[model samples]
Target: MISRLITILQESELLLSDQEIESFSEVQPLLNDEDIADALWLASKIGSAYKVSEPAAIKAVSESDDAIAIEVIDDNTVVVAPSPMVSAYMPPAAKSDNGSMETPELGLPIQVQAAPALAHPREISRSLRPLLRKVPSLTRSELDESATVNRIAERGIWLPILKPSPERWFDLELVIEASKFSFIWQETLDEFQQLLEGQGAFRNVRTWTVKEAATGQPQLVAKRQQGTGIEQDQPLRSPKELVDASGRRLVLFLSDCRSRLWQQGQIHDWLTLWSQHGPAAIVQLLPERLWSQSELDVGFAVQVGSLMPGAPNSKLQIRELPARTEIAPADTLTVPLVTLTAEALKQWALVVAAAGRQRSPARLFDLSWVSDPERDQAMAVIQPQSAKERVELFMATASLLAQRLACMMAAVPVELPVVHLIQQELLPEVQSVHIAEVYTSSLLEEVRPNRGRL
Candidate 1:
């Protein structure tokens, strides 16, 4: 009977280990009719839980003569009829002495519910069960290839690649543009401005007050008048008001109301505003306190442009800011920004892919990676230290990297190096854009238990 049951189980697509089969055989003799029923039910449950086909589970049930009935609850669940033990567990009728008063209620047998069927001991063991669910029987060649690739992809470790460098310095500019319109939240701006005035670049700053048309609130606009004898009380609201700034580049702080920086519309707006002022260049400053996170070793953005002139995408550059660079305690701080020429952008992409190979906490690249054949070949040379390490690597790069890159695309496909070839092919047509900017300020506030609230 045990051998027959094993054959049925295998026919039903339930693969059991040798030890499991032996254990099932050992316990087969001890199972009453009820136990057999329960075992069959357990088998059905196992098949369903492991995503085995419903037909396979049904076939297993039909093969078992001991199983009076089988009912499928869903693709993942099954129900079996009550065992003989359950049907036979009625309470014995009470005996009446002399049979003088035979009360129907007292003579009637009381029905007792049967206990739930127990799965095979070996089957119930967590360690052994996982081994059983090793694969599905999908055998199509295309499907098999897809499944294999997906399994590897799901493992989440991006294989890093090393390629020949172009040997030219990435000529990029970090344009820090400031506008008279303050983008900083009023309270945050006030506090930060006070701190700046107390310490670094704004030691001798002149201020002008203007009432906002929308809010009717007084907005204090600050300017660092170090050399030109502009009075501290001069009322300057717009870029046009700065008459003393003749030939030199105008550094103004424009408040970015919208948080997303990659939007083409935002870039267009900046360009339009810059064109009006006629400054040789513009400098934009992001709140340093908000950007600083231990995860990112660097603290600055670079200037990057496309290979094609007038590409629909913005010419914004991104790069790692050195951690040790001195920050002036001013609302406006100056730093060199790099612009990415066509070749430079490609080189940067290669460098980014290479940097991802290192197992270190970094912030330069949004948690995204592009796969290349060369990178995969390079990564194949190194073996993961242990199972734990391999698992960790998968979890870090898996969905995180892919999702971030998707977001960076923002409905427009930019031909970036190091991404998969398929992604490049799909770029022009892939319209979905999901951008997620990592603001470390919020994370820092949450993780620092000992520090006071920012």
Candidate 2:
């Protein structure tokens, strides 16, 4: 308190005698810490407010603002009128040469950047336009009868003379597996949901996150808005809820297909029920090249074509589907797996709508992967000890994109802003998932958690 008083006296341009400074010791004990703090704050505020003085000037009538006035209302008291334009509590604003108050120049508004998707968003959306759908309701939607008439005139014989309706659509449910490995596809699935909504191919596109419940069964959950403006998931439903036996709901599962459940037959069981009831399929996140490495068994490769082929009389003739006489019973009934590519997706939609007439082009996964995976093949495992060895192992096992990003980031060694720079400027294909891959690969360390720079 005594030293503070001395400093306050010095700032006021007043040199106090040693004896005068010592006199504050006598009053220091009488004031509490709160009182001392208030005094110091007030002294500092007054010092900054009036560090320098200038002559007062009046403004024109057009800008006639409220003026602050000090009035002697009592014998030993003064009442100062408050001005709203600039409060006395705040430090006075500095004016420019033209007499206008100066402030920092405004900059652009900040925005949060979204993560990049696996493929071009628009292209993927366009490719999904031919998803297998139930027959559209001709009565409820606009139809082109001219096309039906033209088709009848072109063909010598007329069938039902039905018109095609594009507007009538059904509800769709997209279930994304909420697991460590599967979460990497979160950005892709989110963009997919938005694209489905934009396409208006479904009456309503509902998104769900599938997670294991306490009962050890995988349950489906949907996110809902709470009254507090926060998001919360709805109560998880039983596995049976995942299957609409009436075939009214269309469900699509976005998964990496490497989970333990897939090998345990749990995923297959649910898919069986869903496929039996309604249009259901799995969208594998991994590329087609890596499909063999996943839990899905490498079944016999067959070309999926239409049920009828080489009908010259038919205006729209499709290739013939594979014969069922030679194929095993297991291959005839199995869940369809598809990649995000247009060709794979188109074939999947065909098999889905074929309704027993045709099956997926991909092999019917064998139960060997689920029952006895180690029967024929020997597993090779390596334990890396050194950091360099660990990094080498990670690079060997990581995705090609992640490996590329890790090499680039290692060479550059940037910190926080490096993500946007790499994604936007250096490599447009770089995704937040790839950056995270490098973070988890043991190739980078958190040098300083609190700092923006590393």
Candidate 3:
């Protein structure tokens, strides 16, 4: 029944956060689906009975961009976001014997539980900043002739402190996943989405949700108001449509990876396509401990050779390699699974920023996931390690543009634009020493497909 309810939320386009999902998972058994839905909708909003002790705190938290996703409710308060989208789809509640509407009582009451872990998912979502903000941020500095001449004439200085023309980058696309029938869990989720947009450090954040369609295919959805004056779902976009060929867009998919569509491999195909074209990663909706239970661990976890804000390697080699005797190479795609925690996002920023660059041992997402039921949640294919190790594992798989820049400079067939891309895009590029080492290694192979560029 709980599983069925989860399915409802996913199908209804109500995005719930990890904490909310956990709350529902532990809910006491419901008499039926309608009761669960009514209980959830009314519990957070039952007049004074459901009101918080600190209404000002609620207002302040709602107004605060930083405080949005964190846990603010006490034992007495059941704070759920009211979603017309949820109410529209949920079954109507049954009335009592007297024909008066029966009030639904919540199955989940606040209780003492295990101590909070070091990493809180809600707090992490509110605070995690993207380390790699834009991909290949291109720019050119032009001399400000008027200012420069004036300065030279007035103060006898030659520095232009040039005016830079940066390329208009793509917006950050935040994708979230909900289950089949979990409309009741949308409260904290709306706040979580707002947090990502408000505090995620991206200039523009476009959130698109992934949900299981009635046909059982997972789809990309947008909300639109119809001519009749009611909000309705727009036509679904195929997951492949999310790809940006310029490798500019930074795509973040937030999911617990428990949807049937996820386990069915439909989600995996598009994720591969997204990573290949540009920077993309799953902002894991599950806590770290339960990663093995989901589809996150299907890939072999080899340490990558290199990453960004760091020099690229010449023919990178993965270290401390785990032997995957049974895992086939063709089945793996290097899609990063990242938690919303600070350190994890830091590493993910580096790894994903380097997605889709040419490398020796293939590239990240080279070995895509083949979700196996036997292996599903049985054990994590990619185990938790230090952020450095995570980055190394990712880059060992192959760092993208960073390694490319190193290769270009190493071979000495450097284009001004490519160098500028690194210097401009990667503002704090790697040190001269690293570039010098690439030159010193004598490891780069020069290829001349066309003599003009060479």
Question: Which candidate has the top score in lDDT?
Answer: 2
**Candidate with the larger lDDT of 2 and 3:** 2
Model 3, span 1-454: residue lDDT tens: 8786666566555656566667877886424789878877896687543222444455433444334333437644656543323233545679867697754543454433322222244645533343424343455666678888999999998788577654334557778776632231233345555665655456467768787778887878864336885647678776666665555666777766656776677787777667557666676654454454555555444444345422222223344346554545455455555664555665555443454441212123323334555545555356436656744543453324345556555443343333334443443344222332232222333343332122
What C-alpha lDDT values do all the predictions have? 0.32, 0.57, 0.52
Q: Model 1: runs farther than 4 Å from truth?
A: 1-220, 223-236, 243-246, 252-454
Root-mean-square deviation of every model:
32.4, 19.6, 29.9
Estimate, for each residue in 4-113, the C-alpha lDDT of model 2 and write its tens digit: 76676676667556676579767764567999799879989888544422223222223236656655544445566666565536556688777978543334545556
Query: Which digits, one per residue and each the tens of the lDDT, describe model 1 over residues 1-454?
Result: 8797667677666757566667988877544799879987997988855443445446535645466667777666777777644454656556667554332332444444322111121222221111121122222222344445665688864444333322211111112222222321222333334432442221132333332333332333444444664425434355333322122122223232122232212333333333233221221122222232211112234333233221111222223446674544221111221111222222323322232221111122211121122422432335356657754543443345334554453343222221222233433322111111211111111222222221
Question: lDDT for model 2, on a 0 to 1 scale?
Answer: 0.57
**Model 2 pairs whose backbones collide:** none
Model 3 misplaced regions, further than 4 Å: 1-164, 167-170, 180-185, 223-231, 301-306, 309-321, 324-330, 350-454
Candidates, ranked, TM-score: 2, 3, 1
Superior by TM-score: candidate 1 or candidate 2: 2
